[model samples]
Target: MKNVLNDPVVNVKGIGEKLEQGLNSLGIYTVEDLLFYFPARYDVYEIKPLSELIHDDKVTIEGKVSSEPSLTFYGKRKSRLSFNLQVEHVTVKAVMFNRAFAKKQLQVGDMVTLTGKWDQHRLQITVSNYQKGRAKSDAKIQPIYALKSDVSNIQIKKAVTTALSQYQDDLQEILPEEYLSAYKLPGRLEAVKHMHFPDNHQVLKHARRRFTYEEFLLFQLKMQLLRKRKRESTFGNSQDYQAKDVEKFVEALPFQLTAAQSRSLNEVMTDMRSPYRMNRLLQGDVGSGKTAVAAIALYATITAGKQGALMVPTEILAEQHFQSLQELFADKASVVLLTGSVKGKRRKQVLQEIADKQADIIIGTHALIQEEVVFQDLGLVIVDEQHRFGVEQRRVLRDKGLHPDVLFMTATPIPRTLAITAFGDMDVSVIDEMPSGRKQVETYWVKENMLDRVLQFIQKEVDNGHQAYVVCPLIEESDKLDIQNAVELYQQLQEIYAPKTAVGLMHGRLPADEKEEVMRKFAANDIQVLVSTTVVEVGVNVPNASVMVIYDAERFGLSQLHQLRGRVGRGDAQSYCILVADPKGEVGKERMKIMTETTNGFELSEEDLKLRGPGDFFGKKQSGMPEFRVADMVHDYRALETARTDAQQILASGALDENPVFQKLAQYVYNDKIVKGETLD
Candidate 1:
């Protein structure tokens, strides 16, 4: 049985090479994998007499076949097997379409059990499934699994049944018996069996809860272990907190720091001073002073005789940060920008200064992590728009220094549940409070036909000496159509307000220098109307830009639309975000309505998570969220919290190292973390 569990799925009785390949598409490779392939849902049917069946009531009825089943044609291509089923004094018509074979299987006076929906209007049972026996007294809950096109639920259920019958006893229990009893959870074997074929809803619920807890527990344990490994490692460089320097920097700022900003800065300061490296996530809403908070941390790093590198996702943002930091530092610390556009002697000079520690603050895009660009005494690394970069890229920058204090900044406000699960390894500080004088961007959901009105409104705003942005969705990978869309929109806007206002165009297809130039024009108000794609979703800050017209807003996620809207409302001017979308579905309309109703990013994020699920909420490509087999971050938040607490308790009890079962489980989780490049040691 143990060997059978470990064998390839093709070794199962009915699963041949072709069927095994089909199962493999669903991530089933071995017998053990097949055994754990949980069902997406269940079809529960109760055994009932024909007389008790009503319209749309799914049930199983056992009776004698009073009439011989006959195959008959209805339409040009439709055929069905018809017969009369009798239960005492009640007789019901039974119909099975496209089932000529059933005619040969069943005869008059034969006993049969038919499972289907009862249509009272027709006084018939539309047979979905059948068997040659009396219906069981107990209700049958059949597991319905998600499968590939060629693989049916019946095929998977049969395979699982065979595998379970042979090797259910060999399934190892990862959770200790003590904890199982303490949690009042069933054993692994019993849970697996009941999960696939439960006797009742109660058993099914218990099985689901047990497995959900296991999934969440394993993830939480992995994160905790990773955190523990990092804490124990002595490779980090300890830095002086430099409270005086931080205070001096804050005093130099033009505006006052909000309470949330100050608290977040204090958190960063404390983390930097610790012996262990600072791995923190700084989450703040759009227009929040996260940049200012990061600037303070960088100031402290420079004051402590260390170089600070701020990595943004775009060249325009890097330049913006460079200019802002340069002015803020004002000859106190030498700050330089190193982007792909900075070339020849200029690039070499910047690189030399950075490497020689002459440049106290260096701001750049992905160019900062290149082989040639080196940092001297790099103590602090601030990653703006952290989700844009991959884990390896972030790691490479962190490795530039010996245990650099990494502070990741995201303008996208994450729900608490997501923050805990997705970024469990890092310490998090949220600047939930926006700085004073920041105005909430007024949002409106407009139909596509209202484009002219929106454009006119934008023109009026531009005429009032305020800038505006027109954002379009990326339609194609080649970007031929997307670029053309932006270009066409730019021309259209130019023609509409041509002699009165200047317009610029930007897209992913443009060169780095051109993109920077366009953004520069927009910032300087040289371009009153800038037509672009999601490229302006982050870091193109212009206080004068008071209006944002998002074309095809239905194509964007709520968080993304929020981020684009964030590009505006930086100034005290009453900003407007006009969403011009003709959504085709309820979800999309609901997203638009939510945006129109509120300007709170956190609230919008919660709604987004519920509406779009986690995959689309954070963007599946770069969200870096763990793929859970059973645990859902949104719906199963309670389970996640419980699992987290239990994991901590288990770790504190030293059971992970003392018990062989827990040790194996920890090892498995650790190995999985390694695969994701999340291991600390």
Candidate 2:
């Protein structure tokens, strides 16, 4: 009701300057921030009677101190307190380590609670904590907060204890009273108190339910509002295209669309044909035909009397798509290529074609977003490898046209948790199934001892007129590394394959022109063996490259290894992905085993998310998911869905725009403070 919820952390007792700095490092600046900083996990000790207590079970029991507490000093800084407690006409021996301070507090008749494990064999309860009353200490449900190096548990608990009381009246309910009643949720203050220190498991569950809902609701509101704003932004039917043209274009393709591709295309075409502008993402494995689907969408845009723009991450990819599309469309649609290479007169000619409504589909790299590029009635925008480009870069290209329907295409299939959060603003379409008659890449995990055999195998493949890629993780010789480098591998492979096989070298450190040239040579089969790094992992289609040998494969994530594997299995020829590494750890061994077992990108991406954790999977700064206090992206998925549904209901009810409390909460969401750090985008 008041602005007092923004009380500074210094207002809390015991939070001095140094301590405040420590808390600040953990992103706690306000009293509210400290209040909402939920525990990483909870230590639950079920409070039970002596009868229900089992052997070696961590539990809490309420009883009387029937025997005087005996304190015995042990080794340095250690003491053991032994006592007997009377519970339901039964006396059980209790021993606690390093709790000599409680010796003075316990009398012969004092009622107390001890929480720990009951060792029935020895007839003793190994107590971890003792309290004056029932369910008071060692918390039947205790919270374990994540801490920084400088902060201590006592310091945070003390400050949080003070803030919990001082701001008790200030936590006005943001959710409407009716919904809270319907959900049987506790008051805001009660929930926060129970979250930090719960009396029992049932109360903690209810508290967690409340916070999880609130956290997800704020994020889903942001997502819903973004879509609503786009729909209301007035890009009308000009973005729409008839399905008949798209059908004819698809019918003309050399190969038929897979069922998954057809499903994805139908979803995209439905969005395109709507009065509202389309905003969708088509994500699939590397060779799942996302390009062909995009091509059909582009052709639809052209036939609808509007232009299409296909933006890629690299110049080489742009050139490849330009050539492929030019051949695919033939004389039906005028296609143009614009990149940094197209300079002076050539750039001017392409720009004029785009401006005069002559270029039906324009393909280029980041150069397409330059201020000089403009389009006449640009209706559809297809971005390849969309993650490689910045949000602003995509926006720049879209701005050149009056509200173009955008389709972002990525070869890397996103895990569902990431898809729901990172790309929440746009609708998603996934092509999960590969085309029929496609060759499944034969994958193998081999150790370093088998290097010679792998090399000989690559040479044998090259001798059969097929190209092979030898990928190293590093660029050059580093101080004391044991793994292969691109340059050394390039040289050694060249020396080994000699005279009979031509080898090319490519890595991230190579100049753009040099890498592109090497890639071109490999694609043309001029180079039978390409000793390169993961730079070749960026959707390079050299169908003739039938073998992919990943050096130090254990060093890469499952998703990256799968992407590397996808590069080789694109053609009709039988392909092989050899993971060359001697994995020393269980995780490394597991990664290699998984890579050898499955070629599904989605499955591998999920495994990657679990193995690497979400932070390393998507760099902390780049993860688009909002920072949540209590809701977990991985485990609290059902809560997230409920919140999303509730958010839509709230939006449809006009509560966000009309209700006073919701309006204030909406401002918090707009300022990115509701969930703290991550941007909703």
Candidate 3:
């Protein structure tokens, strides 16, 4: 069994070099991988009489070929094999597309089983799969695996069968033996075999339940351990702030805090004052006043005679937060910005203030996480756009203090399912509603043919003494994706609005200082129009930029489109977001409709998560989310809760340390290295 697990997938028959590469693409490396690579779904074939078949019903029917199969070559690599099959003494027309090889297997009197959609009106069957002779008993339930262009599902099924047959008897069980018996789960090898080749629906369901519980248990064990450790490990100072003091400060604010903001702020304060270290996620939409709640928490932390740090994704955002805090706490706390750009003697002074506990509130970029920047008595840490920073980066900043209360803030409203799985160890607080009297951005979907009109509208907005932003999907043209790129669109817009009003260009490829310079120019309205990519998606407040035109908007997800739209409507003046694209598919059209209909970021995020499946999930940087192969955080949430309870009980029972099987499991969990609330704020 050990050798089988270590041996390469090529040990299985028919998995040649090319198929090996395909399996590698799917992250399948060894024969053991083949055994564990379960099917995405199964097509259960129930043989039915032809007379009882309904319209478009997919089923298997036993029949004899009454006529010789005639093959016809159609347009461009297309072929159709048509034959008359006598099923239950009735002749039915059966046609198979692209499976020209079926013609060679069919004879006048040969019996076969065909599974396909039966078109009642056409009195014909569209066969998807067929067996030359009577269908094998085990073939009633066929495993269908996700495939790449290089390999087919049939090929993968055969390989999995070979590996399972070779190592079924010797497969090792990872879950504790008591768990198997208590949960009424099959043995590890039996479960794996059932997952790969389910004999019946009941067995398949049991197999799936076993794996789902297995994954959720592992994930929840890690989360529960983190939670347990946090509760037990108390801070020496044990963050303290008077409730009345926080409430009085809130009352003294110049502007009224939104109800949502107020509620989230209270939640943060409660967590901060708790005996255990606070690990929490603060979620709000773009322009939802998350900064206010964060500022209030920072106030409470500082008032408690401890330092507070606010870290953001970009230097501009850090500067913005720094300015806000500086203004809000003008006569209250000493605020300082310690970005990478703050250099020489000034940087030294900032470091001195931080070390000497003079800077009550220090805001900066990733520079705050540097080894030299030490917090005198850091009690509360607020990380804005938490998804931007990595796990180790956040850990470094938190480690600077003696188990400080960490509050993660994000303008991007993460889908609830993602939030649960991604930050299972942390408590979540959401600011769903925007502040009252905030102007909503009026979104419009403009087709490709209406480009001139959209450009004219932007030109009109610019003429009316307002700046505009044009965002593209790509920075440059690519051979693979033929879309409107930032540089090309910039050049075109520059040519159109040039010599009169300046049109500046910016993208991710630009240097940090150069990008900052362009942004500053655009923010100051020195540049009437700024053409850029989604680099401007994050918090780069430009209230003066009233018009946002997104090219190829359909190429982006709903959440992204909403974020970009948020750039406008920050000021009081009416704002507009014009999406310029033509989507051919219904999903893309629905996305466009959602955008044009509403400006709620959270609603759009849920829709976006549903639309983009596990393939794209959220985005490229979302690797921090739990990568469960079988368990779904969305659909299997109840199972996840059960697993969490079971994990907590097991931990409390000391099984991880006392039981031999659990000892091995503990080692495996440690190797998995599931960190606490790193991303998905």
Candidate 4:
């Protein structure tokens, strides 16, 4: 019967071909998938009398029908059924729009239970679901599932109930008995049963806790195993770090290195010289000199007779890095850039140089991972804005060499808890200090009514020989979203600041060449103002751009807002970031206030995680993180810590080899990694 869990959803009792197709649309193909598809919310049907119902409150009420249901027609196509109900000494009106079936079951003096929201202005209860008569027992909590097209919550509930009844006895416990005792968790079968149909809120909470812990434990176990494999693997290149050479490189720089930058570089240097392969994450705020630290590491690798590769998210960033590296390594190493746009003779020449070991330092976008882009004795791989690349993409580049030391860098600072949970297997280095002469960008929150004032400030900043960026949430006008868009705003700004200031437009919809051109013009100060979307959030660096005005700023996450604000304040002049939005909700207002209060990326990241959870903080795809079924990086942080420790203990004790359940869990994680194109031996 254990095999029943893997049976297709079509084998379920109530799910037919049509229903199975709908379920497939929701990513539920197997019985196990159906069982794990937990309810998004529960509708508690606590019976209440009519007199206890409040205006605009959703409640379930039991009452006796006081009048016959009457059907009312608003127009030819619209009609509603209305009736009166009496509960104890109170009378209330009940209405069901387009529910003709409800009219037939209801009659005068018949007792019924209905669930809906009460409207005080209309003095009516708009019923969504109703029972023909009061139940013999108390009302039970109902599960409201997330659905796809043509699939109803009722259908999902029925299918899930059938699956639970048939497979409950066969459900195997994945957690070890000792772990269950230590954590005081319920068995797998009981947790799944209770999660779908809990007898009480306490049971539901226990079930949720068990599943969340399981997810975190499995993830931690996988991460620990990966770390073990990397440490024991003998394929990595071990390079020597010459302190004098690194010092010479640093001293020759145009500006002094910040303390934080020095510390991060030292960490990287130490990792490079270590026997074990280095898998490190370098995090810093925007403009925190992460590039300079990475440059030093690349220099060290090249100087050691090993080639290095740096992968960026966009071509514009790749070109920028290429130019910067060329200037930085003017007399030192051969530098080359390879992008999709570099074609024919140029592309072939670059590839030949790389394959021939002539190009010591290589920088490019996704084109770096193509088959033709081979490396000669590649020893170091630095992934800029690491979150932009998937785990498999990173693996592909690393596989180009015999286990090259990998360094992942990101400007989006993650919360400490998330960093531990998400990247627990990798070493972390943070550049928390800004370089000297860099001033914090002054930020302000303004309503839409202050648009003119914001525009005036942008104009004034441009007049002062500084550039400005006007960011919108959308590229084109969206009928569904009323936020300001780049296309329309570009036109408006051109008309408003035109003749006086040069305005440029950029968005993701633009072609690669066009985007590069616009950014080039903006950087060269040919365009005084650039109206664009969040594409500039990552790696478009213009030191002279001092003013950033983000329209519909409330639509962005705090971390994102911080990144956008980072585009400015890169030069010697004082900068300003104006958030033009009238956030109506408390959360949005709070997000706006946080942006105005601080420039610390880590603090803002923590707040963003708390406010929006890990999913919203960064898309799972963008972050290259696995989507957890039950565990949340923010809320289940305690569970994550315990799981990490227990996973380590289990692996260290060699108990995982003897446990079939642990083996199965490992297999599942491995399969997921394989699906994502991650390398596993």
> Model 2: per-residue lDDT, tens digit, 293-385?
999989998878899889887777788899999999999899999988888888899999988988899999877768988777888888876
**Number of backbone collisions per candidate, in order?**
0, 0, 0, 0
**Per-residue error (Å), model 4, residue 100:** 4.4
Q: What is the TM-score of each candidate against the true structure?
A: 0.85, 0.81, 0.80, 0.85
lDDT of 3 by residue, 9-128 (tens): 887777789989999888899887778788877787777666788898787888899999999998999999999998887788999999888788788999998989988888798998
198-230 per-residue lDDT for model 1 (tens digits): 989999888888888899998888787777666
Q: Which candidate comes out best when scored by TM-score?
A: 4
Stretches off by above 4 angstroms in model 2 are: 13-22, 40-151, 176-187, 199-206, 240-242, 386-389, 398-401, 477-482, 658-681
Number of the top-ranking candidate, with lDDT as the measure: 4
lDDT of 1: 0.83
What ordering of candidates by TM-score runs from best to worst?
Answer: 4, 1, 2, 3
Where model 1 places Cα greater than 4 Å from the true spot, the runs are 1-7, 10-22, 46-97, 100-139, 149-151, 386-391, 394-401, 474-488, 621-623, 659-664, 670-681
- The global Cα lDDT (0 to 1) of model 4 is 0.85
Tell me how many residue pairs clash in candidate 1.
0
Report the lDDT of model 2 for residue 225.
77
Query: What is candidate 3's local distance difference test score?
Result: 0.83
**lDDT minimum window of 10 residues, candidate 2:** 672-681
